[model samples]
Target: MTDKSETAQPSGLPYAMSAYLIWGFVPVYFKLLSHVSPVAVVAQRVLWSIPLLLVIMAFRKQLGEYAAIFRHKAHLRNLLASATLVAINWLIYIWAVSTDHILAASLGYYLNPLVNVLLGRLFLGERLRPLQMVAVAVAAIGVAILIGDALDTLWVSISLALSFGLYGLIRKITPVGSVPGLATETTLLAPLALGAVLYFAQVGGGGFGDDVTTSGLLILAGAVTAIPLLMFATAARRMSYTSLGFVQYTAPSIAFLLGVFVYGEPLSTTKLACFILIWASIAIFCADAIKSYRASKA
Candidate 1:
């Protein structure tokens, strides 16, 4: 059985912050690889992550745990589904960053926590507090505004939110450790990733060996992919979901700053309006969470 007490510890805050900070800065990394195809980048990310994860598993002496997980058909299926979702998320994010749609990608992540709350209510029979409901409704309004004003790129945000939300939901219910589970997901994806790399290489389009700098960056994707996830898993184990949800905003917030200040994505009036509503919704959500947490403590 999962230990509920583990989620309430304050010590996990640093891990959570570290994970979000890394995630927030990820667009910069992807931007450096903008010359490469999104599919190729994602393939490289998946392929490279496997060895790094394996090494971590060996160091942690969890290789046996990983082997044992495969024995369960259900766990394998869940991981396969999660692998698909995460792959889609990665591809979309890479494409968005590469195509100068970082703002849209950032909006997607901003919407993800609300999506998670909605998912919890729908699938887990969790009750949403009144503030939570209001937060969701406000976020919905923001999304609607985006749809009305910038329908062309709205799908990017929506797809990213849905894919990642579903991925988290699956992983939440799956009875596997985060590292092992990620290893399994990458393992399932490795064949397709390898094929993609080979195809790109054959076509003289692979970024892997085209230059020393690009090759190194592509390899670094492995650490970039693995480290934050491990930290997130650790944080999830050590902190309440409410606190984690609050911290999750740090990533999108940084991405938003990067999108506006660094990448120079336009902040048109409509987009600005949408962001305002979303931020308000997040504020409301956080306030409610804090209130409830305090009440529980008292």
Candidate 2:
């Protein structure tokens, strides 16, 4: 059974902030590994994280949690789906950052929450507020304008939004906690990651460990992936979903800044207009959510 603790709520603020901060700066991290293959980076991140995650799980004595997850067939299915979506999201993101397509990456993440809103309306039978309705519509307009110039990048944005939105939905329904859930997901995918590492190594492409810098970054990737997840889970347990929605924007906002200034990616007027509209949309949506949360709390 999942333990519910009132005490768990208080310690979550730092973790939540840390998670968002780390996530916001991820463009910088991947930029370091730009020369490394994105697929290989992701594969190693998944593969190398297994042992570290396991050690953490053992230390936490959450093996019972891990065991219980596998015992529930429905939860197993959810984890698998979540894993697939997250892996795809990660791969696409790494590629986008490494290839100087950070602008497209920013669009994808910016659109992800809106995608979740649509999914909630369609699948969860949630009703949208008036502001939310306008927000999404405006965001759609923004997307259309951006797509006019670079239609080819639309798939990247769409895929990132869809996969991540779906992953969030599935994760919300999962019974397992963060550490164990991530451990199990990574564990399930570990063998494939290991095989790929070995195959690429044999072919002289060399695995992450072949180079000191690459290996170090790969290990860091595991820590990076696991830590935010743990923090997000902690925050989720304490905070309202609406607050989470608001905090989620911090990541992409930082990514946008990094893309514009650090990566030296050109931002055309059309793309700028899209981002402005999207930001306005997010502001509207968050205002509505805040009002709703206050009303419910009161």
- In model 1, the runs with Cα more than 4 Å from the true position are 1-12, 237-242
Model 1 lDDT per residue over 1-298, tens place: 2223334554778988999999999999999999998889999999889999999889867788788878989999998998999999999999999999999999999998888888878876768999999999999999999877899999999999899888877777776777888899999999999999989989866799989999999999999988997787667656544456678899999999999999899999999999999999999999998898899999
Q: Which 10 consecutive residues of model 2 have the lowest summed lDDT?
A: 1-10
- RMSD, one per candidate, in order: 2.3, 2.1
The global Cα lDDT (0 to 1) of model 2 is 0.80
Candidate 2, residues 87-178, lDDT tens digits: the string is 89999989988899888888887888788778778876778889889999999999899777878877888898888778766766576777
Q: Indicate which candidate wins on lDDT.
A: 1
Alpha-carbon deviation at 172 in model 1, angstroms: 1.3
Clashing pairs in 2: none
In model 2, how large is the Cα lDDT of residue 1?
Answer: 41
| Residue 276 displacement in candidate 2 (angstroms) | 1.1
